[model samples]
Target: MADKTLTSANSVLLIGVTGLYTVPQQLQGFSEDDMYSMEAVDTAELKMGADGVLSAGWIPQIKTMGVTLQADSDSNTFFEAWYAAQEAAQEILYGFGSVTQTSVGKSYPLLRGVLSSYTPFAEAKKTLQPRKFQIKWQTALGVPI
Candidate 1:
């Protein structure tokens, strides 16, 4: 049988105002999805004109990505500091980076973006759940091996 384990996976996040912040660990992946997922900001739409003509149009949307990391001390500290910095700076500190799923031999490019949302605190019964955040990136295309 093949080893279906995630051997080496990491998400390297590079902030514009600061520097690179590498999450040196596997992400919290969904049961029926990839480790990292990309979603469009707006879906394409089709409109019917008065003359029964179909017109399709879509806003040029820069894809957004969802990333989850273990909410350990390190992650909590780093993100807290980052959030504080962003708040103090009073500016949109965008970022760019990549996610490498070595086991699957696939990589994703994280383009210019900022942390759209972040979960500062969440707790369970004697368990530190992963911290899920959203990144609104200009582009996030998958590159298969």
Candidate 2:
């Protein structure tokens, strides 16, 4: 009974997880008419050197769900190569459900906060900035029983 479509890349991955859990609380609740229609364009002379410091970029935020399923593409390349082959191996063992262990034991407890490095790339789009978020969950009778 869970029929869903919602594409446009799933509405840009649900607006990148609601702008990565709300843009740093909306830049710390800025007010006074939001700093008078906001305009502060002096990015230190556009952050020069080293190709404008790699094009003067910034976007950081992340909170684990194993770094959002390792920046999913159905969890790191098609359900992890069909959970490591054997001819679609019972469809990746009934579509991934039981592989757990993390009290620092680590056996894919949803990839342990994406291999932990204090995850943040617009809240775990796996550190590829310029806005990022991704999600793809499928069951519709692909077994979860």
Candidate 3:
């Protein structure tokens, strides 16, 4: 197959309510949403012999998913997903999916993650107009499906 540069063409984030691990129903992308970022685990250590010397084998770790958005006063998904997780009040299902541009779509699930962090504004600078927010989640066990 010829190489093709992939961009965020067909990216999606679906967050829903579920007590179990079932994939959530997809939702409409927020109006001000800008980007989705996934932080895949860098390495995992496994003891193995390489050239008769002990070496730590490496493997891809679960991805930490993130999405950045210009502040939207009306979208309550953030409050529902992040704050709820903080309080352990209820289970919220979230997933992020990406598709490579191809004749037939090549989709990758960056994270079927569980919401972990939400930082609305780390520093509310006067110069930083148009408030931005970040919401993050860690991959559930055996995630990135």
Clashing pairs in 3: none
Candidate 1, residue 92: how far the Cα is off, in Å: 1.3
**Predicted structure 1, TM vs. truth:** 0.66
Tens-digit per-residue lDDT, 1-145, candidate 1: 2744566444343333244343333233332333345675666778999999999888667777775566553545555655777888886666666676556667777677777787887566587666676778887667974
The residue-level lDDT of candidate 3 at 18 comes to 41
What would the TM-scores of all predictions be? 0.66, 0.16, 0.51
Weakest lDDT window of 10 consecutive positions for candidate 2: 10-19
Model 3 local distance difference test score: 0.47
**lDDT: the better of candidates 1 and 3:** 1
Quick one: how many clashes does candidate 3 have? Answer: 0
Q: For candidate 1, what is the lDDT?
A: 0.61
Order of candidate numbers by lDDT, starting with the best: 1, 3, 2
The C-alpha local distance difference test score for the whole of candidate 2 amounts to 0.24
Best by TM-score, which number?
1
If both were scored by TM-score, which would come out higher, candidate 1 or candidate 2?
Answer: 1
